[model samples]
Target: MANKNHSDGDLKGTFYLVMALGVFIVVVWGLCFGLFLDRF
Candidate 1:
């Protein structure tokens, strides 16, 4: 039971990290796209 709980915690942490990274990338990509469009 302890091992299962630990694994669950790890899974949740990884999920949150991945989600944060995805949002960061999306924001960066949007900013880059906007800058590129502005140049035109």
Candidate 2:
């Protein structure tokens, strides 16, 4: 039972990390795209 709870916590942490990384990527991409439009 203890092990199961620990694994669940690990999974939740992994999920949050992936979500944060995805958001960071989208924000960076948006900034780059905006800069590209400004140049043209």
Candidate 3:
């Protein structure tokens, strides 16, 4: 039971980290694209 709890906590943490990273990537991509368009 203890092992299961630990695994669950780890899984939750990983899920959140992945989600945050994905958002960060998306925001950076948008900013880059905007700058590229401005250069034109």
The estimated TM-scores of all candidates read 0.71, 0.71, 0.68
Q: Model 2 over residues 1-40: C-alpha lDDT tens digits?
A: 9999999998998999999999999999999999999995
Off by over 4 Å in 3: 1-8
lDDT of 3 by residue, 1-40 (tens): 9999999998998999999999999999999999999996
| Tens-digit lDDT string for candidate 1 (1-40) | 9999999988998899999999999999999999999996
Q: Which ten residues in a row have the lowest lDDT in candidate 3?
A: 5-14
Worst 10 residues of 2 by lDDT: 5-14
Q: Over all chains combined, what TM-score does candidate 2 have?
A: 0.71
